[model samples]
Target: MESEELLGNLGQEENGVPKKEKKSPLISLEKDLTFYADSIKEVAVEIMMEGISLHPIFIAHQHEVSIGEVILNKADLNTDWTIQASTLEEFIQKGIIHPDKKEQFLKTYKKPENYMCVFVVVPQGANFVYYPYPKEK
Candidate 1:
């Protein structure tokens, strides 16, 4: 009864199944991720073009964390991801990148003009990755 009240009353149960089908979590997560990527693509490009730094690093996270400016805030949506945009210089300033490792990161850094650097944070882990602007046709 409580569940029915929370989920809204479906017609009735038949053969041990509710009348209304519940959506799959995987499908919902996939949709949210797609929406997030589509919504942030343009903002990412603009961040790169601003000339703050040749390499702009973005963080896609679901929890509160230090560093970077929140370019996109979707906290109001339970399934959406929030994005924080930052540059290499800011990373160093924030102590995210130690001075010793700066050279190593720079050495392996891809062309900033061609790619948007993104640090994706998930329950599993986090990694620095890149995506191209002017998305393929």
Candidate 2:
């Protein structure tokens, strides 16, 4: 299928309104590094189990001072992973990611009002790690 067609499908909803996906409990104001990391891993494993070879992208959005949200997007499922991965690596090297809780930072980066930090989950041996995309100036 063409990329455009696939994107169109993603935007489609049964009724005009988009269906709400189950939000991950890991998104919150309190810091939980292990929980966030495990959540990302679970998402990747779930995708793999579904027979989807694409790597999942988890975009974090912080809508308020204390509230944050996470939305999962599949990078390889819709686009080229090589190009995306390279870009993300640059961001990580530049320190776009949070110093400690890298995955948790996503909650604030992809906010609905102001998008910032973006990251892609890359396979590292038997685990997954977040590779951030640089925030636009």
Candidate 3:
């Protein structure tokens, strides 16, 4: 019996190794999404069971959180971040950050040290990474 293939043309060879894939825009998205979709159930289950860990950095920063916040998004710097949300709302509500720049600031909410990065879950079913604060002098 012949096996059916799921995508693109038949895999080709190059220099004795299988060639890399060339994806169309839609195919590119589907490939990425299909991979995640395979894990979505597991992720949902894990979130439901063990749940996510969070730190309350805002509690201490209180009325002065202009410095912003960060969280670890990858196992190491060599990898891209799995997530990178921010404390724009929290900071604004606390009067540490301004509301006008919320969208701009959130766009650049960066990831922190791999060892120190951890994410905070917002009420909107998203994440905002929270990293260990700098040590006081």
TM-score of 2: 0.26
Compared to the true structure, candidate 3 yields what TM-score?
A: 0.22
Q: Across residues 1-137, which tens digit of lDDT does each residue of candidate 2 receive? A: 23222123233355788656645433431133222444445554554466543333343322111111233222322422211111233334444433565556445333222211223222111112333222335
Per-model CA lDDT versus the true structure: 0.63, 0.32, 0.32
Off by over 4 Å in 1: 1-41, 76-79, 123-125, 132-134
Q: Find the 10 residues in a row with the least total lDDT in model 3.
A: 56-65
lDDT of 3 at 102: 66
lDDT of 3: 0.32
Using Cα atoms with residue i matched to residue i, what is each candidate's TM-score against the true structure?
Answer: 0.60, 0.26, 0.22
> Looking at candidate 2, what is the lDDT of residue 4?
29
Root mean square deviation (Cα) for candidate 2: 16.2
Of candidate 2, the 10-residue stretch with the lowest lDDT total is 60-69
The segments of candidate 3 whose C-alpha lies over 4 angstroms from its true place after superposition are 1-86, 112-137
Residue-pair clashes per prediction, in order, are: 0, 5, 1
Best by lDDT: 1
Candidate 1 vs 3: which has more TM-score: 1
**Model 2 clash pairs?**
60-106, 60-107, 61-107, 62-107, 109-117
